[model samples]
Target: MSRERRKHVVYITKNSEYHCRDRECVAVRDRRSGEWLREHSALRGRLIGAVTAQGRLLRRMRIVVGMRLCLEGAGDEQLVMTSVVRNVGRPKKSATCAYAYQSWAGVIGA
Candidate 1:
């Protein structure tokens, strides 16, 4: 028997800034995207924390403004900050689906 690969929901930020609110919480914002990920929102704070932690771990640097980040994961599973690039010119296509968030919340009972 073979194990199936987990599918992750990708969230791509455009010219975003990652703010570590505290040791356990994090928030991300973009001028165009507004406040998509917030510590106090229905979305799990640990998810944001995991993104920041993994980004730092993989890139060995702090996330700064004007940096584009790709956050991928689902539910309470281990999230991954797949890409962290600076000054990449044009914004990539948005991969985050609003309906997905709603469906996740429904399934998880947010």
Candidate 2:
């Protein structure tokens, strides 16, 4: 049996509405398509951290609560709708990805 792959949907306020930092995971939004792109150090950071069993659980990430996420990889993945938020939290233990979401905002919660 195979476990179902999990899909993450993130809400991003247009830069006009709320400034974003993409704090949860580094992300970028397309100018025309409105697609958010996401990566967590090529998904390796979590795996490396997992080896120690101290941290690096993806789902437990508090930033994920209302993250500013973009679909990972290619294809038809998309967010349902964008929501407004005041602030987003940065993870205490995780290192920022190389891209580091400088191109866009971070997280999606107030």
Candidate 3:
């Protein structure tokens, strides 16, 4: 038996800086793509804290919410702009995988 993967589509904001120290620096992500879209912060800092603390669980974090992401998969694709994280809750007790989406994933790796 095999398990299915998950995927999500998001429009990442352009030319933005994410700061954790100053709340005033906070701002909702804006979609700069030609596609009309609503902005959402997909990943949160709480999740980062958990990942940082659990070094034994993952050797390195290739992805983090709020990070500027570019697709590295096979074939030439333009930089897929999207927000890394929307929100993060308290850590779960039984998380095994290094990458995860808490609430929803639109596709299983499209």
Candidate closest to the true structure, highest TM-score: 1
Candidate 2 lDDT over 4-78, as tens digits, reads: 243332223444121223322234344356443344222211211111123332343333323432222222333
lDDT of 1 by residue, 1-110 (tens): 67424233233344453332221213344547564443323233333422343334323233343343433333555544523444322122242243235436653224
TM-score of 3: 0.21
**Residue 43 of model 1: what lDDT?**
34
lDDT of each: 0.36, 0.29, 0.28
Estimate, for each residue in 9-84, the C-alpha lDDT of model 3 and write its tens digit.
2222353322221111111223353321123242222112212223322222434554443322223422233344
lDDT of 1 at 46: 35
Q: Give me the runs in candidate 1 sitting further than 4 Å from their true place.
A: 1-13, 36-75, 85-110
State the weakest 10-residue window (summed lDDT) of model 3.
Answer: 19-28
Segments in model 3 whose C-alpha atoms lie over 4 Å from true places: 1-6, 9-11, 15-33, 36-62, 73-110
Q: How do the predictions measure up, each by TM-score?
A: 0.29, 0.19, 0.21
Error of 3 at 44 (Å): 26
